[model samples]
Target: MKIRSLAAPFRSSSRNNVLFLSTVFLFMAYATDAQHSAKGDMATEQKIHALISEMTLPEKVSLLHGNSKFNVSGIKRLGIPEWALSDGPHGVRAEVNRHDWAYAGWTNDFATCFPPGTALAATWNPALAYKQGLVLGEEARFRKKDILLGPGVNIIRSPLCGRNFEYISEDPLLVSKMAVAYIKALQSKDVAASVKHWLANNQEEHRDSIDVTMSERALREIYLPAFKASVMEGGAYTVMAAYNRFRGEWCSENNYLNREILRKEFGFKGVLMTDWSAAHTTVKAALTGLDLEMGTDKKDYNEWYFADPLIKAVEEGKVPMSVVDEKVANVLRVMFNTKIFDEKRREQGRMNTPEHQQAAYNAAAEAAVLLQNNGNLLPLHFDKIQSIAVIGDNATRKHCSGGLSSEVKALYEITPLQALQQKFGARVKINYARGYEKQSTFREGNNSGQSGSLNVNWKLIDEAVAVARESDVVLIFGGLNHDFDTESADKQNMDLPYGQEILIQEVAKANPKTVVVIIAGSPVQLAGIVHRVPAIVWSWFGGMEAGNAVVDVLSGKINPSGKLPFTLPVSLAQSPAHALGNFPGSDLKVNYEEDILVGYRWFDTKKIQPQFPFGYGLSYTNFSISQFSTDKTGYGKNETIQAKFTIRNTGSVYGAEVVQLYVSDPLCSVLRPEKELKAFQKIFLKPGETKTVEMPVKVADLAFYDESKKAWNTEAGDYILQLGNSSRTIFQKVKISVK
Candidate 1:
């Protein structure tokens, strides 16, 4: 239905008539609940109850199911309009434009694309995540979308998880903080932020039928923290249950997950929708807290497992009328708060606004982590080089969108070749070659009857090598693409796919001054010839202004400030899940055998050195940390510790340093990681300038989950507070006794 339009008041000449007209307008405002007061929310709550009381049982059932593929039903008699939803986290997706699942090519649906979640997390800047949310939300509001189904808070337990590119981090604390920031910004713009995949949805393999079995300690310590913050702290209005079964029941209808935890514990008063026909039974879904069922059948959205069966169950006395009313009421509350019935309508949003474009550029620039710079070869001077060689398929292809539903029809994308040419027009000559072809899968558009993309041209690699030999310096753009990183099945291995390793080795031999700019979502294995390269940098799937962001860092226009959110292992076998022989279970079961020790935790605990540790990244300038101390040497379990340190930019150029605080428990009841990241701060400084940094350490931060009691316990012992830039690069330590 179109938005309601009100007629203009008559221009009467008489003062008495004008006075009467003004009174009518005031009455109309009060009637529509337009002029809301400070206590309006309380009144709105009462209105939801009142509306529920008036609705018939059939009407209530319709509200709890999808009215369309992307909308919920509303009662026209009560003047309640259906709410619209869009796919999100990164960008307002192109798919949401259509009434069904097909794309509509709607001009108004065009949106400004932002950097991926993995890239945003790589920055280690929650503030940037907030900006990402705000920009994406603004575009969602323009598209007339009420709810954004996004901010997938699943931890990247394995790099090979095809959908890992969409997740934020391997650490729960970082993911929680980042999730909250994004949720707040999105909700502030009147768009409901939907935090998704409620439980352990680590792998896409056997997603629908797989049984994820794990201890309670692991769930509380790792998986559930981010979802808890999303509801209790971030005030997210919607949550999408995962497709996998947590224990024996599906997540959509799991009583403990949907009721005891989410609704009762976290106080989630919003809607809980299933992940596309994930609901197995009507009785469990109705009795539990599953509110709305969407996309169970996208093509024929008219039919739903929860819709007809639910009404029948309610009439048969299996389900109560009160349960149906609660679901309908929750949907109504979201509609009320989002201003769906407001008198004025918002104008359609245009794509590529200056502010939105700048935010995208800034995120990509800061997210590029410098892994290695042996000779300080970066911050390259264009004047010193007469000609430069740029080689790879990634340079020519568009990288603004990828990874399942998060892929976007971006307004425009600036390729690395275009950005480089724009930077050095005629002063420095730039030559580009199609180094190697990245294989695109059927779903990702290739190599089958599905899309027919096949061709591994060694000739192209040979041409790129010849070009590298001629140029003074070379930049190789290579890594995973949409084909390698998508939803459905996990990637085969961590090695750069399809002979890119061979291509990089040949290019490096041709030009010794080769700097490999990796464009992967997760850590890639760079063992054999990677050490031979002078400089190595990892740049994730950057959005619209990625090309510009890359050039800005290379030309000394912007300094690299990003750090690794997850640890980079030497090989797949070294990883915790893989080492335990627990990943990709044979009988449709994935075990959490690592048991709260993931990523850096696994490597640190085992004393196994990684390719690059977590929190590791290099800047253009050097920095030193000193004078580390704590306010107290002893503290009670209830008290907090304050760690103080001084960081100075001890170099000739301005740069930023990430001050990471980790807790080291020497003696504990259970085995613990050597050092777990508790807090981190990113601060910028001028050359030769020093600043004092203080990070407050909560006592709860040092606690371990006691599985026996199902509680977090902080044992009395000597705890070490280690301050550093990265996991392996500890600068100083101050021991404190906790009693």
Candidate 2:
């Protein structure tokens, strides 16, 4: 599927015309539909549809694939100019040739790396997510990239899911709400946004072939909601299908997901493209609602499937002509919505605005969470603290740390070490040590190391211990990286790797007032010193400027306001997904026995507590929860119970607190979690500021999948809603009856 070879079939100008014309015809059909007739905006859409009808099939297909350097001429007659494709969820990967082009690689100069997706989710503020999206859109437009291939919305199913750092949450509702805001903000800026890795794209192992066989109930309830929210609510302009399969069929060509679910059910009026090299069957994909195949070495799927096999299917009635028209119409619709025809984007500058960089910094700052701060260990006053010791491999190197397509070149990255020095020069003594090195760095050949040896490097531990003894306070930075953490080909247990544990132990021994910061992508087991560490910060590979963001929080320049998006597993053995075995393996038939039970849900349902519950995070300032009560006991079937609480900032400093609300189903036909997160509110308060927050819990929020009943409904019983700062700590509760 070389670009040159794929280009051969699409050479004929006449063939390209057919593809374009067919799409126009379909648009006309939709425009004339009774539904559009009722809508007053039919004239504009109809004109664009009519214009699309004049294009040839090859031209239409060319539009499906974005304008690449190898192609983009067929649609010249339609005046569709070439549009460049670029990368960067953290920062723009615009550099022509950079090292491996991954999280650690150098992005082209000018592209600012913001905090990672999980970091934004850590804020638990959709408004902030939207603001970040607006920044990403501005940056993308400046770089002249037509579509920003980002906002990976895969579920954080397991702590071991390597790419979990890039996704939002274990709960679908929160992820959906956050994603919708992000998409809306990005698209509002006129930059095409792609909500990606559609449906059950949870694991990295055997990702290309793994069969995600969850019951339809789980699919709709847990996995598909965020995607639906992004498209249906956010009006995302594009969607990228995953490299895996849903049920028995490949995701690109899966009819249920692509057609029945995404298109018909959810009404996703946008371009549906395949993940790079993710396309399987050509004609089947088109028939199943795939409008485009991206980065395919230029596979002329149109000639191989559409022009020849596609027409043959129509002739033999195996594939309807209407299907081709639908695909083309969808493509045209995206182009129209993007204003691809009316405006030229080349005039826009590339990575020149300080506003963009500031946005990145703001996003990073907002997403920084203070996971644990016992005895008020954080907001380290530089004047009061004379010395600081930074220890860990993460302290030295910048790891964008995740999986496939995670690479991006940051115009400038503020390493934690660099940021600390920049903010507190000569004023504070800073000692540093590398707690661990990449396993391959110590190996003879490519990456390889024994599992037992993959903890904190022992030699590095001794140096860090010495530094900790001399310093006033110690900051131990260590966590998983792509080499040791990811869903890709390489995977590891959810434990601190290679001597990091030993380093933490030694450092804690040397300095009892030590703070531990994790820089991995997802939650990891922190048993060795979970109880010993006075302050613990879970920093999910905070983006290009992550280093600076971490420094800001540590130094009290920026208050830590982020919250945990996933639960920290006490041990790999206790993880629900672990029982299923290494993902995409164990005979390739792994079942989600936990079913709708995910993250804290599984832990609570099975009564297997985690080291840290989901939504757990400590603040530098103290806050108290009071006045907890529901407005009413019970009402109509759809009526909601409002739980109001007044949160007072009792500490001396300003800070933010996340108020979490959970609902419990006392009894049900199927097994259910003891309590599930129904709603949450993040409030920022100054010293002594008290705010009354209200959260509504509706009957619909209590529904669960009852396998025997084969339906989701609220069981008739007394339901309990608990309001707390974390899953394990319930500060307030209210009992209600569902009729």
Residue pairs whose backbone atoms clash in candidate 1: 277-296, 447-453
Please identify model 2 stretches exceeding 4 Å from their true place.
Answer: 1-40, 66-74, 95-109, 297-318, 344-352, 401-404, 441-457, 485-487, 580-582, 705-712
Model 2: per-residue lDDT, tens digit, 179-262?
888888777766677888986888766777787788766776788889988888888888999988777888888998988888
Where does candidate 1 stray beyond 4 Å? 1-41, 95-99, 298-302, 345-351, 444-456
- The CA lDDT at 164 in model 2 is 78
* CA error at residue 115 for candidate 1, angstroms: 1.5
Candidate 2 worst ten-residue window by lDDT: 441-450
TM-score of each: 0.92, 0.87
